[model samples]
Target: MKKLLTMFFTFLKIGAFTFGGGYAMIPLIEVEVVNKQHWIDKEEFLDIIVISQTFPGALAVNSSIFIGYKIGGVVGALLALAGVVVPSFFIIIIIAYFFLQFRNNLIVDLVFKGISSAVPMLILVAVISLSKSLKKELSTVLMILLTVIAISVLDIHPVLIIILSGIYGAVFLRKKVN
Candidate 1:
């Protein structure tokens, strides 16, 4: 029960303070779940991040579900989910109620523009942090390069890229027995 409450409050704080969504939450999640609590190691956290990105939902929510389940089973998952969602849900509700009235206000528009500009920097921080964990192998480097090209230049769907990368890794990157 105590663990469950801790998980809930941890995720609640994460959701309440984070502004740029999932990617922006990665470093904070790592600090709390890995460094602070020692719930999972860094590799496991990276795996969770990969899994979260591969799935359809928001990365932060997916990560919370995975971590919560790992720690406290089904009930914990629910508590964590609720904790992460509730703050955003209420905040969005309040914002929506006021936003309609202030839709044309220049100050609000400028504030939104400032936030939009900062979001990319937050995502970049996440990317850099994640990259530091990557193995310095040729295949890993190539995969990263290919993925970037696929997403930025080819405009390929991320799901398809993930699928193809998985297949490529399995077939070509797998180690052989002596």
Candidate 2:
């Protein structure tokens, strides 16, 4: 009961302040879940991030659900999901109302631009943190490098890269269970 409540509130706070979506939430989630609460270790958090990205829907929502389930079962998952989504829904509604009112304000426009500029940095922070948490292995490093190149240079869709990476791992990188 207490654990479920903790999960709910923790994700609630995360969902409230985090902007620019899942990548922006990573650092905050890391601080709260790993550093403050010690709910999971750094490596485990990164692993969960990877799994969330490779799986489905929005990463932040998926992460909240995964952690919630890990801690407190189905009820926990529901509570945490509600916590994450409710804030965004209410905030978006409120903002939509105000946006129409202030759509022409120069200051509001400038503030939104400033926030847009910060998004890339937030994503870079998440990438660096996740990479640091990963084991320094040849194959892992090579895969990361290739992924970076593919996204940056080739402009490949991330979903395609993810799918192909999985297929490559299964076919070429799979090891015998002997």
Candidate 3:
């Protein structure tokens, strides 16, 4: 019970404080789960991140479910899911209710602008942090570049790209699972 509560509160703090959605939460989650708590190693955390990104739901929610299940089984997953979702649900509700009243306020606009500006950096930090775990192989680089081109230039569907990439990784770029 105590461990479950700890998981819940940890995720709750992460959800409450992070501003830019799942990508932004990556670093904070990494710090808490991998670096601080030592609940999982970096490699497993990265694998979970990859799996979370591949799935349909919000990355943060998916990550919480995976990590929570790892720690304390089904009950932990529910607690963690609830903890991570509760703060955002309430915050969004409050913001939706009050946004109209202060929509045009200069301070509000400035604050939003500030937050928006920081969001990109948060995402970048996540990218950089995750990239550290990626193998620095030429094939990996080429795959990344090609994927970017396929999505950006050819207007390929991301889902298709993801499926193809998964196939490619499974067939050719297989890693020795530890």
Candidate 4:
């Protein structure tokens, strides 16, 4: 019961403090879940991130659920999910209620503009952090380059890329069971 509460509050803090989307929350999640709490190791967290990206829901939510389940089963998953979502739900509702009145206000506009500029930097930090953890093997590097090219030059859909990558990993990158 105590562990479940702790998970809920930790995720609630993560969800409330993170300004941008799931990508922006990656570093914060790493710090709390991997570094500080020791709920999971670094490699496991990276795996969670990858799996979260492949799923349909938001990355943060998926990560929360995965970690929660790992820690405290189904009940923990529900608590963590609620913790992450509830804050955003209330905040969005409040913002929507007042946004119309504040839309043209100079202070509100300036605040939003500042947030817009910062979001990109936050995303870049996440990308760099994740990249650093990636394997430096030739095949891994090639796959990374190919994925970037496919997305940027060929304009491939990310979902298709993820699916193809999964198939490729299963076929060519599987580890031998000793």
Q: Residue-wise lDDT of candidate 1 within 90-142, one digit each (tens)? A: 99999999988999999989988988898888888888888888888887888
- Indicate the residue-level lDDT of 153 in model 3: 100
Alpha-carbon error at 169 in model 1, in Å?
1.6
Instruction: Assess candidate 2 and give its TM-score to the true structure.
Output: 0.91
Candidate 1 structure lDDT: 0.90
Q: Report lDDT per candidate.
A: 0.90, 0.88, 0.93, 0.92
Query: What are the models' TM-scores?
Result: 0.92, 0.91, 0.94, 0.95
Candidate maximizing TM-score: 4
Q: Go through the candidates in order and give the clash count of each.
A: 0, 0, 0, 0
lDDT of 4 by residue, 1-178 (tens): 9989999999999999888899989999999999999999988999999999998999999999999999999998999899889899999999999989998999999998999899889889888888888888898899989999999999999999999998998988887322
lDDT tens digits, residues 69-105, model 3? 9999999899989989999999999999999999999
Worst 10 residues of 4 by lDDT: 169-178
When sorted by TM-score, best at the front, the candidate numbers are 4, 3, 1, 2
Which sections of candidate 3 miss by over 4 Å?
A: 174-178
| Comparing 2 and 3 on lDDT, the stronger one | 3
How well does model 3 score by local distance difference test? Answer: 0.93
Score residue 89 of candidate 4 by CA lDDT. 96
